[model samples]
Target: LLGRFFEARAKGRASQAITRLLELGAKQARLLRQGTQVMVDPLELVPGDTVIILPGEKIPADGVIDAGATSIDQSMLTGESHAVDRGPGDEVYAGTVNQQGRLEVKVTGVGPNTALARIARLVEEAQATKAPVQGLADRISAVFVPVVIVISLGVLATWWIATGDFADSLSNAVAVLIIACPCALGLATPTAIMVGSGRGAELGVLFKGADVFERAKEIDTVVFDKTGTLTRGAMTLTGLDSEADERLFLARVASLEAGSEHPVGKAVALGAEERDIELAPVAGFQAWRGLGATGIVDGVEVAAGRARFMADRGLHIPDRYLEALETFERRGHTAFLAGWGGEVRGTLAVADTMRESAPAAVAELRRIGIETAMITGDSRQTAEVIAAQAGIATVLAEVLPEGKATELARLDAAGRSVAFVGDGINDAPALAAADLGMAVGSGTDVAKEAGDVVLMSGDPMSAVVALRLARATFRTIKENLFWAFAYNTAAIPLAALGFLDPMIAAGAMAISSLSVVTNSLRLRRFH
Candidate 1:
């Protein structure tokens, strides 16, 4: 019963982060009725019901926007600290906040169907799926009892013959069996694993299986996904270039982007708004994937996209403008060419800033002798700049989203055990494919499903903390096993001799268990 209590306590502590997540969920929501909005419980909502999402309010359900535009702070779900802009037709998730502007959302998911709910379910499943550590004690236990029986028989026959006393011979053999009960050996590995798992939970690092404690030490390389892993993943307009009237050029581009939903488009629109430029109304807005948007703004056909996208439209890009584009890209900014009337006007640049803790985190991994590399869908120049900022020297750039797992496999084929860290829908495959997949940040359900470890915080420094903790915990496990086995091996022979008694052997057995438990508790003090 005491052992069961200890095991239950540790398992409960290991799920603290998941409990904290559940607390953040809103219990009610404001719903849009036939002609007015009413406050109601979240359970009352159903698919197709329209919900009114005001500024500074949590979205009650996952659905597409019916009207209005606002920035939704999805940091808790996506681990993206930035507020993402959502307009009509854009999807809004339950548990995310509408930072600005009034929005009417058509509910597509509610109650158990929400992304937040799914994430909670994933956390529960992760805890349930965890298997106990298979240690040296279990293997020994299988044969130790049988071998002890044989030894006890041999001791009884020898003692009976030597002394010709039946009572003394039987008493000596009983003492030997009692002293080698393997009580401490049974307690050793489990106590340490429980405490270590709980300690990991306290640090917002969840160990899904006992195998992680064993496998983490073998990791030789750590692969990080660029967008949400190293960088803030919130793209903001940083630099812009124009041959004439820079503000006017920006206003023209922003007008066309007003109808678009791409991150780059939203960043451009936001940049123009900051300059207080009134967006010129646009018509016939056409958005092409991999290219940019083309629309009629202020009676002129204006265009914005990659350099190749501009060229395809028969636009003449100036040599100076081309040079400026290279300059922005070389600096790790995604640049676009804006044009009108067959002439390139200027360039717009946006960049995802590096997280402040990225540098220290990368350095820590390197100091510990783990090679770090970044795999990203971003262009090579952009990947290089961000990698340098994060102090990562090895960069695998221009890899498509689907190709991330392939890169991890390539590294594995080279005889390197890798740990991949990422937070994004597209990163799901790579997260599962890695030897040790760490789902960084808020731990979205999809990413969590594939990850071996889930980081509750968005800070990259937590990765360093996790690796160090794994090594420390595994060390404790080994220490406990050693003391347990050594104590049993030496005591059994002394108990078999006529010099030792049963009472003293029983006391020693209890003391050995107490020592193992006390040593395992030391992990709770780990940072």
Candidate 2:
């Protein structure tokens, strides 16, 4: 019992990454109150409070920036080491470092609701959810004790009746009892689970339970969510329609999107800012959810969003512009229409760049005979474009977040076992519904819950490492079970037949348990 307690505690020590995250935040923040800087506890801060952040300081809360521009190191949170430029209205998460420049940010969330806090809570929950693995020895031990007792009594009765020698019968019975070797059976599964899971942790792959390792061997189809899974979730303006005046169109769109917080709008505004284009002051600013942003720019009403937003507002597109838009869409770019003064000014295309490691990761899975598929909420053209770059052959496009699970069900009915990989709250249902769900460690709390395994590195290649490691772990478990059962099965009867003495039986039982432990320890050598 003491040995088992130590083993469990050792396994738990591998999951201290979240505890390290909690230590990264600033304990005290510089609060900006009516133009005065005041020192206060970060916990005392609330939403809408203007907090001043400085260079080499940890952000105290999640909020949209209000002033100053700085490059923030968010690798601790997103697993991407690049410093992202943050300015007014850009979201900065808690626990990230402000590398240079000072900024005043309006707090939107603090404490438990902050992204850093949520990740820590999710990680702790994932660690606690692992269920113990049962081994072949444990199953036999449940009913083997009574059977061993009966066999011993039968041996004693036969020896007494045949020769009437009490010493001989009792000695033979004692041999039978010592040769049972239940200890070998008991240690087989747990020792392997301890070593294998610990090894996985070392590689940044966390198995939620010992059972999850067994399921990975059966995965045939690997489904990936697009945004953030294959491509960087951050969308940026890639190109502007050729017909539009670069300066005039950008100025109109950026001014209209000034007050909008949507990713598309932010991309346009950010693009304009990057080019040093000064935005005009706009009136009648409005944001259409899932559509576009509209406002008056330079005394002319301007709108920028998807083509549907323009159609809904009675704006018409020329055939030439529509053809060019399709060309942009084919290259995996999401195009938005920017029109003003009742005429279609031009189309702007924004695209999420594919992760640099995505292609190699897909190729590795394919080499192992596992097929790769991509599912996304983006249009069919955009989805295919992203999939092509990643070397994924099958694409499920325009599928809503809720419908991803439905697609998984369709694959299940076809006798294909699927593994879903994602990094969002919306992917929770599909992640839970798949045969094996892998969550990016940097994702939301709900995503981690639905995942059977958490890839701590948040890299797609880690998913491959996870599956291969699981199969290897399962193979190790089988070997341990085989050696344990084979040893006891052949040795028990030899002792009963007087081929082995009581002392020899005792030594053999101890050897059998030692062999099982020694074999399970081999999992430590796994790469």
Q: In model 2, where do residues sit more than 4 Å from their true spots?
A: 1-139, 162-168, 242-262, 276-314, 338-344, 443-450, 501-506
lDDT of each: 0.78, 0.78
lDDT for model 1: 0.78
lDDT string for model 2 (169-194, tens) is 88888898888847766666666666
Model 1: per-residue lDDT, tens digit, 197-292? Answer: 656655666667666767786788999988767887777898888877988888888999888876688888988888898998889999875467
Alpha carbon RMSD to native, model 2? 5.8
**Where does the lowest 10-residue lDDT sum fall in candidate 1?**
441-450
